[model samples]
Target: MSFFVRLSLVLALLLAGGCASLSQQQRDQAQGIAVAARSTEVNCDRADRCALDSPLRALGGQAMAESTAQAPRHYATILDEGELSLVARLNLIRSATRSVDLQTYIFDTDDSARMVIDELLAAAARGVKVRVLIDQLSAISDVHMLSALSGAHANFELRVYNPTFGKAKLNYLDYAGSVLCCFRRFNQRMHNKLLVIDDVLGVVGGRNYQDDYYDWDREYNFRDRDVIVAGPEVREMAANFQAFWVARRSVPAERLNDVGKALLRGGVPALPEASFLHPERIEWVDEEAADPDFINQAFVATALPVQSVSYVADLPRKHRRERAEEPLAGQHLTEPRLDALIASAQSEVLLQTPYLVLSKPAQKLFKNLRKRDQPPRVVVSTNSLAATDNPIVYALSYKYKRRNLRELGFNIYEYKPFPLDAPIDYRQLLPPALDGLPPVPERNRMIGGSAAGSNVRGSGSGRKPSVNGSEVERDVLRTETRPSFLGTRAVNRPLPVTRKGARMGLHAKSMVVDRRIAVIGTHNFDPRSENYNTEGAVIIDDPRFAEALAQSILRDVHPDNSWVVAPRQKPPVLSGLNYSIGKASEALPVLDFWPWRYATDYEFKPGPDCPQPLRRQDPGFHACYSAVGDFPEVDVGPKWLLVRMLTAFGAGLVPIL
Candidate 1:
């Protein structure tokens, strides 16, 4: 029988019998697992000295002061310019001397993930206490190997949040079983992505430890963003990590499987170089020559002069509170605090998220914002139908609810993927379809970034220069008309990277408050992030850093990068009908754009296609997906129809997915 047939059989047994019966040997294997219900309390951040001044203080030349005394002043350095973001993360790992605490939603079994994890293991071996807390949903592949890595060193510990029964690390079947068996808890995942080393530095944003997050994927790359926070506020970040580390919701990796105990047997080395898959991954970056100088510069560059900084977090058990257990009126709630932060915005607000399923309460908050006489200028940037990694979310939020959002003064911009610039190298890394991409203009990416009031195109390269006797015009066009009453502008920005990749997905979750205060974290301003997952962010209230961040975001709204979404004409009848149908059927909801989902041609893809380097794909092994494959999740047999049926009838699930 085929694998699908076997999967269906196994699922039938699982649903009917609750679980399959284990053989004597299987039972023996499981008996060795540390299945004890209680966990020992431990301080993961005992060595945290983030509150003190570091020997290496960043921005010594820059002049700035904080607006608040209670908050520590720091700077935010955005890694959105180019491939510098990739090294910035790795550099943080290498710079750690005392401890490294990493928590994320997903850490896939990809080249990027391998390199980062290997670095962590190396750090642990160097007596740097390393603690890794990952959402169980993302630990599907390489679980056994990860468990071994965790047990290999006494200083390293791996804990998974809300795991399921059976071969969780190897199969996606356990997700369905988990959702079916424990619907409520299973949906409430830990969505926060955070990394802090030695209690002083924290990197938070939408990135998970995967190849796509780092723009290294062969087929697609995420045009994602992350921010670095250093200084005293990192202590609070560490405290929040400690709380989650000991929470009842988090389970030790060894408790989930027997392989954790056999780690000492040491069959395969967990180092990235030893892997058959990514043995050559470490060589991607020319380390020996460039690394020493780069690391030194990055150590100071990553740290910013802060006016003020604060950390915000949702309790690990945010979704578990019962109706009666809810805090009384006027009580400060952790999950609701993000809303409070938004409410504090005075003149302007720039919101960026990936998935956007608004809850009833959130809708009401927007309603309140609309009622203000001088409402803050609200601009929201999220994934468009073509750019979204999760099409189901697009069906629900964009397909069904977008018009309503437009009516509420939301200047919505669907994030456009960075075009595959064909002027760069990576001859062996990417597929043949991707060629002639632009190179990262390292000279243009100056240390302090673009100055305020300079022309948007000022890279010191002067005027729009031509390459190879042709203008490097991008393919994106502005679809929005000027001066609508709704104050709603739709803009799509081009990906700034010059990497050899087919497409880009917007995975950055961030906000800019009044153009001075910035926040970066993993919370998607949607129902899933608001009510179903634990999320966090670090707030940097500094003018210089915020200006740098704003400069990057403003470029995304530039006409050269994205296709603006505005009503040149009334939306089509079919579009409206499909949206209504989608609302009625959230799961597998189809949009009018459904038929065009597979439109992967460079000429027609969502973002601007750079004109001169007109590198058309081979049209086979599509570089983009139109709601079919499950990457970083599952690959086969799990039908979308099942979700469709559930969405049509199961109203309770609307708040979950």
Candidate 2:
């Protein structure tokens, strides 16, 4: 062989050898981490058995009945922004002693998630057992960060429910592939957000870990709700987490150690302490000495055995080939607590959701209520164009508000950031002094004196400036006492009232049922939420709680946080001829009455009417359009053209099933 040929062979051998070395290193690191995690696995089942004689067992036995009996009487506190609630949640976590189980759909590595993980790590450091279960697909985006969290402590265990190796990677390719993957395992996602601390307190609601969720940014914040239960329901939630944790495809963090190390090297921070490990020191009560009523109302729900209680969940089943033959079917999938509450409603339905894009079926349900003569009065509150974080979704929702009011026959209101009317405090406005005040000035004379002088000033000005000043002076004082007392009473005197400040954004997504049940969840009544992302919520069946929530929605959420979008007989006129001319110049063909085109592509340019960017920022430009330019319109073009294309596309996707 020639010298060149020999050199090429050597290079190939070295390259292959280096690859093998790297692979072995990864395998070794993974095995080491797995061994460490396995060594820390305590016999939790044994611990549960040991604690059977404890007060917890007695408390668990009566939790269900107590809950059912107190269902109608229970009062709920609404935690608006996740930031405020997170502090409470973390405090609970820090109080954990025996066990900590947490399951969520999304957990990012942002400040909020870090704060939680730091506490969890601290718990683990104190020898408190911890387990974290997250959806496999949802965690894919943050796997590196999660792996780092898992590696920091042996007491901490992480598992991903329903691990999809190759298929999940394929999902990243395109939308079509993702849709196909969804059909393959329609029952896969673990759509549960539960946190059980020491098996004593549990929390269930619609909140995920993301910056936007906690109101960290000024642009937008999710209007969501969650409840913290300190009773027997926590055990059920814990069991649910356990089942998912040990499922067939669940991948423990230790098993992913090698991958985690690689991920860390690629720059993911190590996990901190477990947030809720050691239980906080508190006064303890002997089981025999504890107050039954206290336990019944706060923990047990009623004097009923937990074994007799049934917990319902929307766990989908694996689709068989035979089942695929039927037309696609969606199940009723309603929580009993939620259904009961909705069924018991009597007076009105007041809903406050940041995202209120309802599905066709759900819309029809609301419409049917209107068709009946006894339709409950409805008030739907949501974000305005200026308040919404996602403009695209906002645009889509804005188009439907009018139709919902007119066709559905419901009273719809959008949240206005500004107050409608000023708050009047009659006591505060008691005229500085009720009596002995100097005579008030005359309106006509004062106006005339301030303006270019008139000839009337020649004779009228000299009249001793009469007490206050001319005929207008006496009229002013007379008008002060009553409107008609003024001279000639040419103009009407307005009432002495003050205006209040505008309300901020409404961030709670809830519905009141027959004034009986209240449904609060993370799921917005939006297409993307229903069809695309997995969601979860909790329904409480307490009339008092529901009423309080409803009142809050109306008084705080609706009045303070939302803009009331009312219909106008005429389109608002442009601020200037320049604005009208600009709009006319930019108008697309067949724009008016174009539903799809208008809904998707309609851009509210920052004209004088709209909130425009400051001139310092835009320079020569008057205002910027939507943060994302008119891409939807550019993609679909003219309104008429988009309608035809969308219609054809819908027809095409139909046969693919």
Candidate 3:
């Protein structure tokens, strides 16, 4: 046998010979001690979760009370701003009266995550039953932290979804071993971002529990989105959470190898008090959330009464081909919801995602849509090479530029790293009381961080010019690289050189169809979301909500914020020959070395000659837009080579990426 085959056999046996299951006596002893420790921490006298006074919660209650069976009215609000999104979640957690259920893909050890956890613990102290379900790969990796949380409160519980190697955390070697042994099962993840409070209100969308998702990351932040829903529809959201919670893959903290060992050893103290690097900044946000006027203006005013809303989600065991007959294991719900929405498109489909690589089913749907006589205009708002966090996925997108444009009939707009008009609050990046002052020099600021006791370091004191004539922070230009972990290495790999500072990648996953339906959720519209990950979404069928969602997506596609993808201006001589060669190169599975692609990035000129953005097919498009090369604003570096290499050789990664 070859060396590779022998190695695979050894790894497979190691995987099959899993860790011995803990004895019932051991589990009972740990549970008894943890419950005894938790009993002393009870702080509330009321049984009703000691619910706080919240006008937002009260408004939701009134809507639920007034809602009818036939009409089924729901109060739906779009959370486009990161600050507002965080505030909404905080307020809801504070006001929970019965239970708080949170399911997420990432629960990072950042300050923002600490704030949310602090609130959840407080809710538990007040008699609320709190359950947190997180993916093992991206959840809190600190074993001591997990042990502390294991005994924090009797009312609070945490579970890791799909723990590989039966451990709470996977090291580098374990990750590699899993790939060699059980790639399919290990590759599956729980990508749902959901929070249900009192089974009455729920928030679902793409925002994860991380600083970047909430615009608190000074180095980088995500231009993401979420939605809040209340009334009859929230029941469905709660049901979906319960389904995943009871699923076999949801392993309790005390059941995992690392966390269980710590629990068995005892002396695991309760979770530490929340410590924030910028407590004053968090205080300001808390004060804003508490302010009745701010809550009414930011959330209540924006909420609309929608007649139709539904929650759709994929089951926990989403990729069980052998058990395909089982409804809970084999069925894919989120994909069908998306497919049905796109299939019903009459005039247009506006999609916004960080990655543009489409699954085969998605490709077929769009391709069929293009076969219509006057097909609906398909516009995609996605990340460019300069802005994207996952260049590997972007490479696959780059490889299929011709198909996405000429065949799928998509009008693609790539988001800029530092958009001029994104709805981000940069004030949060500053330390307390320094909001209005000039940018602080690196040597002067020394903030401490929570994760790994790492200090919040600053970039060098240098500035660089950006593509949009703005000064970028010196740090944005620097590349940060690490070993590939699962598929995330591809995501967190070093970004190509770009203008300095405050980079924003598109993380919002949404779709607006025909200005009558809108979807906001965790589905990336890619193969990972389609097959490997269990996803969730909220579909609203109200014209007003759809129009609002459409406008939000359009704002991201504005000339100041994104670059248009269009066919490059062909040479007057041998244009036909050039097209033929490019097409032939694109058709290859590997070694597609043609340099000149049919489509390239275009920057909109904002003079009287060209006052607004135009589609590529428009006759006056060339006059108004100038070609800015294929990967505009991206410096030629290792990342540039990586994209080309992956485009030529990464075809096998399409389904997994």
lDDT scores of the candidates, listed in order: 0.54, 0.44, 0.78
For all candidates, the clash counts are 23, 42, 1
Query: Which pairs clash inside model 3?
Result: 473-500
Residues 1-657 of candidate 2: C-alpha lDDT, one tens digit per residue: 999999777655534432222244664566465445433433344434222232323433334345654451122335443444564456555556677898876666555566667767666666677888766554433444555755666788777665443222112222233333343443345656777777656666666665435433222234455655545556666765676676665666534433545543553345444342112211111221133443233223321121222223443221122355553354223333343443344567776676556666657667766776677667776655444433334434544544565566555444433322111111111122442234435311211110011011111211111011101111211111111112223222111111221112344557766555666664555543444333445565556656655654554332323333333222255335543343342232223333222111122244555553222113332233232222221223243243343332332221111
Clashes of 3: 1
Between candidates 2 and 3, the TM-score winner: 3
lDDT of 2: 0.44
Order the candidates by TM-score, highest first.
3, 1, 2
Q: What lDDT tens digits, residue by residue, belong to model 3 across residues 328-398?
A: 55468898879989999999999998888887788899999999998999999999988887787888899
RMSD of every prediction: 11.4, 20.4, 6.4
Give the per-residue lDDT digits (tens) of candidate 1, residues 1-657: 999999888767646543443444543443333332112333234343221222332331121233234544555566563244556666666556678899988776656677677777666655677899988765434655754554456667878887645333523344456546666766677878888877767777777776656645544556667767666677788898998899887866655543443432333234334452444445644262135555445445444566777788876657556468564343224447678767887788888777666777877877778788898877776665556665555545533333434445666555554422211123323433443434546522332223232111123311122222122222321211111112223222222232323455667777887888877777777776766777887777777667666665655544333333432222455666654553344334332333211111122233333322211222321232122221112222333333333334433434754
Rank by lDDT, highest first.
3, 1, 2
Off by over 4 Å in 1: 1-12, 15-73, 170-173, 258-273, 276-281, 284-292, 296-299, 323-335, 400-402, 418-434, 437-501, 570-654
Best by lDDT: 3
lDDT of 3: 0.78
lDDT of 1: 0.54
